[model samples]
Target: MEGHCLCGAVRFSAPDAKDIGVCHCGFCRRWGGGPLLATHCGTSVSFTGAERITVYASSGWAERAFCSQCGTHLYYRLLATGEYFIPAGTFESNDMVMTSQIYVDRKPDYYAFANETPMLTEQQVVEQYGFPPEDAKS
Candidate 1:
């Protein structure tokens, strides 16, 4: 799958689309500049015009890459997962994307799920998705 930033300054491609996870945490909310909708692609995810992609250490264990030109919140890499969480909105076409929303309990109270997609709380994430709370400190 292929994706890019809003200004077309940064581009990336992923060989296979798997190991995807959706994050609804507060940091994700702030870093993404909105609700974060992401998918975990491999480290092989290559970038074109790479210099335009600036990275910030969003957490102790992960970094977020964004388009410096347009401030487009692009993707994040979890050191433990060895996977890149690419924003679904950034993809050319998010046809094959399937997300299991995590951090539901911590999600903003203003919003409610209207879709049938499975929603997971923080504990559920730790238990089922191997997401350790310790690594999530922002």
Candidate 2:
């Protein structure tokens, strides 16, 4: 799938992308105003207008990026593996299924999705992904 930032300042293509994973972590909510509906594009995403991308190191192990021009969220990337979780809304067209949601325990009760998808708590996400412990700071 191919897509670009709101102002067309950053364009990207995620080859063979499929599943859309929802992240309800606090950081994601504070960053995007709600849960992050993103696709795990791994390391196969290609980008254009890279110079217009601004990145923020949101955590010790991951960084989030956006278009410097429009402030559109571009991706949340894992530093060590170069895996990218690009926002689903960024895709021009997609038929990807919403398979799972992470950080479900942190999700506020004000909103909820109608989709019946598997959910994982913060601890489950960390353990499944083999992320460093919260106290590790990296």
Best by lDDT: 2
Query: How many collisions per candidate?
Result: 0, 0
lDDT of 1 at 24: 75
Q: Clashes in model 1: which pairs?
A: none
CA RMSD, predictions in order: 2.6, 2.4
- Single out the weakest 10-residue window by summed lDDT for candidate 2: 129-138
Please identify model 2 stretches exceeding 4 Å from their true place. Answer: 132-138
| Candidate 2 collision pairs | none
lDDT (Cα) of model 1: 0.76
59-102 in candidate 2: lDDT tens per residue?
Answer: 88999999999999999999999999999999987688899999
Least lDDT summed over 10 consecutive residues: which range in candidate 1?
Answer: 129-138
Task: Give lDDT tens digits, candidate 1, residues 1-138.
Answer: 888888888898987564345677878877764567777777788889888888898666888888889988878888777678788788887565455788887787777656567888888878986766734444
TM-score of 1: 0.84
TM-score of 2: 0.93
| Candidate 1: residue 84 lDDT (0-100) | 80
